[model samples]
Target chain A: AAGVIQSPRHLIKEKRETATLKCYPIPRHDTVYWYQQGPGQDPQFLISFYEKMQSDKGSIPDRFSAQQFSDYHSELNMSSLELGDSALYFCASSLDKGTGGTDTQYFGPGTRLTVL
Target chain B: AQSVTQLDSHVSVSEGTPVLLRCNYSSSYSPSLFWYVQHPNKGLQLLLKYTSAATLVKGINGFEAEFKKSETSFHLTKPSAHMSDAAEYFCVVTPPGYSSASKIIFGSGTRLSIRP
Candidate 1:
């Protein structure tokens, strides 16, 4: 089966501009998540969608938002990009969030965004 | 609330030697711990995870982690360090149920280096 896939492997945008990144989760997955990774730091949770509802969010700014479609695909949008927004964005998915065992998340290749 | 901390910023080992990456976590309830590996310009990959069921967890690529509730630690280990093992590793912790919102806390990350 094909793993999660992300679009625009690399992106560049000017300060104050808006940028969007897309992700396609694995088939039959019910949960989709977005994460951001800065240089020399671990990946941080941005937001998650499960069953078409916003389940959780991390310490991201209000300018950031996400949407999950009926097909379980997800999109992340960043408004008024800043230099601090330059980082790698990853999309992950899981079958469910059950605590029975390891709800291992499968990730996409990631999208590198540069804000100048 | 939940948080994770990686004890080292970097670790170096000779080829064929054992590899150890230390991690600690804090949680208000029973925690779900995980270890993820990321190569340069790539997305995160699951190494192992520990739920409430077992203390010792084995994962792909010959990696394993032991969860110690008493010490609040979930440290990853490997019998042999391969050159391909050079990458950044992250320790993550999450609360135990749907009410926890599936939110995850990640550590600062530890970069592994292998000597030829």
Candidate 2:
């Protein structure tokens, strides 16, 4: 089965720079969720979108924003990056993307972001 | 609110020994629980899920979990450990709801180490 796909498996950036991460969810999966896992820490929920609409928000920084496009793909935009932003970014997809969405989620290999 | 807690941060077992990983959860409503295993540099793979069905759920790779509502625990277990089983495991809980803001809560992961 096809799994979620993420671009820029690895990224490096200097302070104050910006970066964009993309996620292509599994086929027929309409909900996308983003998470961040810092070194020696568990994954933290960032945000999620259902059918191109922002559905939930977690501990995502104010400098970061995300949206799901018409293609059911999503992008996470981070501006003014800081060293603390370095971590593994993961994207997950699920079948349900509407009001009732308790479907199982499938994850993508994470993008390792290293900010200097 | 729904939350999960992993009982241990690390566990080590011999190749032919039994393996156990503990998890406890709290949810105001009926919850959807899941166990996911993640290898280094890989995405989280579904090990098993419990949705208020059978208390004993079997998964791939000879893994299984028993849900105990009285104890509020869902612990993962395997009869024997394999080298390939060394990885990080996460316990997750999603509260049942149709609200768009509902999200999954992840527990601090447990790192399993297999010794030959």
Candidate 3:
């Protein structure tokens, strides 16, 4: 079975640099969610999209922005990155009650972002 | 407001011993709950979920969770522990009024370590 795909499995950048992480949800999945996991921390919900539209927002910082493309892929763009931004970024996808009665998300191998 | 709590920060068990990871949730109404596991450098995997349906949810790899409304608990359990099951487990809760856009909240995560 196809799983979600994430780009730049590992990234290192200096403080104040900019970075972008991309996610490709599983085929036919209409909902995408982004999460961040700090060192030794649980993943935290950042934002989500449905049908190419921003559907929900969580504790995402103002310097961070994300969007889903027409092809159902999503991107998280970060600017003026801080050292605290270092973490594992994960992307998950699920069908919004389309077939499966439940919207259980499938996650991708996360992108590890390290801001120096 | 809704929140999910993982009672333990870490748990250790011997191989073939019973496994249990405690979770508690608070929600004004019936809530959607989930258990996700992540191995080192791996993505999150959905172990099981409770969506106002059956209380007993059987997931892949012999993992199961029971939703007890009276206790407001949804603990993941397995009859026996395996070295391969050593990982981080997260309890999640989706607040009421879920839509394609709602973001799921994750617990602080509990690290499960298995001894040979």
Worst 10 residues of 3 chain A by lDDT: A96-105
Native-referenced DockQ of model 1: 0.53
Q: Once model 3 is optimally superposed onto the true structure by TM-score, how far is the C-alpha of residue B39 displaced, in angstroms?
A: 0.7
User: What TM-score quantifies how close candidate 3 is to the native fold?
Assistant: 0.94
Which 10-residue span in candidate 2 chain A carries the lowest summed lDDT? A94-103
Across residues A25-46, which tens digit of lDDT does each residue of candidate 1 receive? 9888778889888877778778
Q: Model 1 reaches what TM-score against the true structure?
A: 0.92
Q: Write the per-residue lDDT of candidate 2 for residues A61-90, one digit (tens) a residue.
A: 999999999999999999999999999999
Query: All candidates: CA RMSD in angstroms?
Result: 2.1, 1.7, 1.7
Per-candidate TM-score, first chain only? Answer: 0.94, 0.95, 0.96
Candidate 1, pairs of clashing residues: none
> What lDDT score goes with residue B84 in model 1?
100
Cα lDDT over the full model 2 = 0.90
* Candidate 2 residue spans exceeding 4 A from truth: A97-102, B98-102
Predicted candidate 2 versus true structure: per-residue lDDT over B8-114, tens digit per residue: 99999999899999999998878888899999988899999998889999998999999999999999999999999999999988876443334678889999999
TM-score, each model? 0.92, 0.95, 0.94
**How far off is each candidate at the interface, as Cα RMSD in Å?**
2.5, 2.5, 2.2
User: Can you list each candidate's DockQ?
Assistant: 0.53, 0.61, 0.61
- Candidate 1 segments exceeding 4 Å error: A98-102, B99-102
